[model samples]
Target: MKHKTLVLSAAVGLLAPVMAGCGDSGDGSDSGSAIVVGTTDHFTATKPNPAPFDPAFAYDTGSWNVLRQTLQTLTHVPRGGGVPVPEAASHCAFSNGNLTYSCTLRAGLKFANGDTLTAADVKYSLQRVLSIHDLNGAVGLLTNIADMDTSGRDIVFHLKSPDATFPYKLATPIAGIVNPKQYAPKKLRDGFEVDGSGPYTFKAEVKDNTLVKGTFTKNPTYKGDLKVQNNKVEMRVYPDAPAMGTALDKDDIDVMLRSMTPDQIKSLTDKPRKDINLTEMPGLEIRYIGFNTSAPIGKEKAIRQAMAYVVDRDKLINQVYGTTASPLYSNIPAGITGHTNSFFNQYGAQPSLSKAAQVLQSAGIHTPVKLTMNYTTDHYGAATAKEFQVLQSQFNDSKLFDVTIKGTPWKEFRPAETSGKYAVYGMGWFPDFPDPDSYVAPFFDKDNFLGSPYNNPQIRGQLIPKSRREADRGAASDTFGQIQDIVADDVPILPLWQGKQYVAARTDITGVEWAVDSSANYSLWELGKGTTTD
Candidate 1:
């Protein structure tokens, strides 16, 4: 999963496209003037490092949102929900029993800067990300590639194991092809310009080394599967959700997405805006509490289980998120296949002081378990402080635990969480793709994205590998279910609630429903003024 400021999650093993949803007019028509899209998602990039647009380093939604329009992958997740379809590549398939993945580059592929985008460039782009292994980069998801070779127009990957999910990984921004000449092979390329072969080529504006805005215009050199529907897309970064909502209300921006405060959502839902078209879609984003299992207090399974019993997901959703989100019982949120209410199945639907006490008493642990919960201050939203406050209230009210709350900025909070500095911390996950594996593998694997010491040998060694080998992703549901059950029993990460995507665009805006897909990949090419027929 690519980390959003809030965290990110994944989907299927099959290469076949699984189509769902409808909105866009498939015609390649550019009918709209440049439109501004606003969001609260931050564009973070430190100096002397790969810029957020550099796919090799960026692992966040704000950066990927820009990269999606500028870079073309071998394959792409469809406009609706489905498996990867050919983008830069004309065709792609597996051989050697799903261990070898090969793709032939589309004829006459060229970057926006007029550089030839050959298979060699694609090979270099993927390899460089692995070699650099930036801490914030997505090298963990791509560790399966044992070796790769470029033959003429074809790029072949030799996976170390039978991984059917490899193709899905290829569809993500992490696998976005970059020009070898412009991008460094051993380190991140510093600068603002990007040489990509997607529907649009972008020039980003950086203020004090942070991405302020990105202007995307149609690339005549682009020869990919997607057709540009809008002439230009200008993505503007806003300070907060209220500011973004104000921009949407004042018509300063044509579209508002990524995040809106629950108060804003409740207000708009209660009194619909005449000029705004609010479209709600099933979201794959989830929020949860992760424990540092290596920590002294966190190492106790009873404490984790007791905390799970005391957690009130309903109250958290109702008080904090309103109707914008639903209570989540598993890491795999609803809408994705193989999702289960594992936490609810184990801990029941509501918080129970009796159950919390019973669990601790049964484990021979002392009453009033001492614990601390941590959360990010600026990463998620202003509402995050209130959300954690609610969590603290729940924990303290249970009378079975004494909980301390700590809030830190994202930059400081991320390092502390990874270094096992926090006992339990809140996190949000947006999917990398629409697969169950994205939810399970990233959190449960030996080298899990979270530095939590939750390495279950059964899950890491047996269940995940077996599930990845199954070509028919539907058949792997049982394995994913088993994995979720194990996670629920172990109480490594406690699932809290799942979010719903709310996009507010002008009435004349076409293809708003198709703009953000299940995996939250913003398809700027699908957004246009009025209807395509006009």
Candidate 2:
């Protein structure tokens, strides 16, 4: 397949001035006027840091959340969810066999400091990201770009190979444009200062690790898709979900976004509260177990396949996750376009000791295969311990293998997993975008994100590149389906479950359902406090 030509429409002009005021209505009821949000994620800046709010360096979800509001990318995903829309760029397109991508900046655009935003800034920002090449950052996504060119108001990127999803990558926070004058070309900025053209600006008095303190104000010079509903948005950081829930009940916080445990969410369902509103959205998150294929135990395809057959996803979702998640049959979750039940079709829903035994027996493998499963105790959530324990019990009970479970904190576990210190480990994925490619491309690539020695020539060499050339994403579904089937057979990773997005807010707060953007990002712009809903 070859890319011919493509073009995008002009970007929208700057938004008009919005009315802003903060005060409680006098009826002993706080109409949706002001909002205080609670979260477990924290974002801060120190004297000496590698990436202080620099889009190129910031990789964590917390930092990206803040950048999403303060920085404008070339394209953006809509509030509810949909295809990418132009933001900073008036138009973006590809020509000459998908090797060339061109973007035209919106006319008369300027930074919050009144400095002109031009194609040169775009070129510099992208080149800087590539130059820094932070391991923790999303720089790998831009590896396809061979070179970039700049004209009067246009920037062009020449890709090493055809990539249909390249445009979708530009819509992410990692592609946020930075002012060349305010930011250094090489190193990240040191202080807690942001000079973005997004809808909001970070308040100077921001304090991290403090509850109910940090705030962001509407940027007067900003122009984008979202209009700032509240004059000031306060963010409260909590130690755990329980603390966040308590704050929500006590009116200390209007809404809670992330890090809520399944038990906490189940409690809300078990005992309904009139004063609280709970909204759930279909999520693109998937939890899976990655196997180091080069390791002694993981080297056996039959052993991996037997483990998959013996494990029960229903128990994981119902008992461990309290039904907050659904059983996932493939790497691609339900919300994504190419999601399928390939695993289920290959191996039935229930764990079958007989089928697992047959698979191992056919491979001439002995009984009671010794395997150790590694998982992070602190990173995933409080329930991760129980989840791994459940997995341990299932494997031991199957009588096919003797399973030993081990745990480590996320900080240590991440490096260990990436270094292949663990033969088999568990990990979860929160999508970079709500596309089927996001599921397969990253995990199955030659140099995959998992750090596991999983290299499938068919998937890495042919399917991915072929799919990338298909401009219509939906039409590429067959390729993704084939990829998932191949993965199920290879058994490099076992898909466990897919989680649902949940947000618990006070009844007075409107737009709870709309708070989560199409890309699964919690957008503060969609939130409001009042009886009326937009």
Candidate 3:
């Protein structure tokens, strides 16, 4: 119910390890070597998954790394989950109980073409995503904004509903303000035609601009948390993780662009060359199992609860992740406020087969009940495939039931899960903000449950509104605790594990702070090939 879609395993884009080169000082700039990086992206991934180049379309972390550098958001979170600072807007104001919001523009906020970032740009930018109408997960988020009016450097947003969380939504790259004049009104605009205001502007694009570089400016107007580090950044997109790892080992690249699986992390650690280094940060991402509430299995709360009992999360985390990640019972990822281990508290201490069987029998579901599980292949990783298989084994191992596992690519998987074509699928949530409301809202609210999965009244009716109305995020902990209990009782989806953001960098690149998992913006601001004197 948490809008988690199960995608299939993809064989594409995984990278192979590469050898290293010591003397490739990146054009001999103050930042030292040009930091080469690798990702599991094709040289050009135009269709199916939204391309990163287009500001309006991309959801992948790989795309955000490039977008964050090229296009600026209105506000940003610092290295950790700190208060957001201004980027496009120097400061913003919200009146009328968090609905009518306004932002004062920075004096010199201008696009690469030197066009000022005017109020009209902000209005158009916000409207464009709504107009396009296809940016996944954005429609519900933007449901608050009634209209956006821009006059000169002043931008105003009128909300359809009163929401304190709106500003945080504005900070997301999907809601990123752009030079509205360049992006067309009603279609997914990605590629050479797109434009933005950030530290970098697209200087050159090859392989459909999958390989892009952003020129850095003083960005005097950019007073946000995302600071500009190097003068320029060149992003090279590889097809998959293995190749990205290969490139890093060979020194063909500077840092591994994104997080890798436990095994991949191990290979980099065990086979570490002098040049390669590992930077393991607590990630803000959470992955879970979402049952299609629209489906018959979801109709029975007992069946969903049974699924949770049978699947061994500890085994999944330790065996599949190899100590790289921690198993989680709560939808909230670790490190974020309001995180609770509801699953462990309820089931971890004693995974009783007898208890699980008894619970099912009491509910009139006899032994040998069957269910199907699904996943998205390329969306997560090879580890995701193994994860689903583990679930299948977990349930089938229980002589009380039968489990079937299947998956599709992310592109197909999103729609399939949304349509309730599958009974259950592997689902993951990378928060838009670290707030408890974000975790509570997306899955349980009827509108947020895009795939027609499970929804609970405590979460949707009472808990959601109560959480949102509060000015202090931490104030809603009691309600959130109730929401968790409701979820456990409903048993719509089983909580799996919380993930950490893992990136193996060459020793030279330092000051690299991976933004919180929810932001997904890997700006080159805090990054340098090594040290910089300038």
Candidate 3 structure quality by residue, lDDT tens digits, 14-81: 11123331323432233544555555543234455444456556655555555666677777654544
Q: How far is each candidate from the true structure, as Cα RMSD in Å?
A: 5.1, 6.1, 6.6
User: In every candidate, how many clashes are there?
Assistant: 8, 3, 38
Stretches of candidate 1 exceeding 4 Å from the true structure: 1-32, 47-50, 190-193, 531-534
Model 1 scores a C-alpha lDDT of 0.80
What tens digits encode model 2's per-residue C-alpha lDDT throughout 1-534?
111111001111111111111322322233435578888764445332335468776665666787887888888766544566778888888899887888888888878888888888888888888887765567767777899889998999999888878887888777888888877787777545666888777754454522234577767877665656666577777766888888887888988888789988777777766666666655667889989898999889999999989999988777888667889999887756667889999988998889999999999999999989999876556788899999999999988899999998655676688777888899988877767777886788844567667888999889999888887777788999999999999989999998766677766565556666433476777667765222
Candidate 3 Cα errors over 4 Å, as ranges: 1-33, 41-56, 190-193, 203-225, 267-273, 514-520, 531-534
Each model's lDDT comes to 0.80, 0.75, 0.64
**How much does candidate 3 score in TM-score?**
0.85
**Poorest 10 consecutive residues by lDDT, candidate 3:** 3-12
Best by TM-score: 1
Better of 1 and 2 by lDDT: 1
The runs of at least 3 residues in candidate 2 whose Cα sits more than 4 Å from the true structure, single-residue gaps closed, are 1-34, 42-53, 181-195, 203-214, 361-367, 531-534
Better of 1 and 3 by TM-score: 1
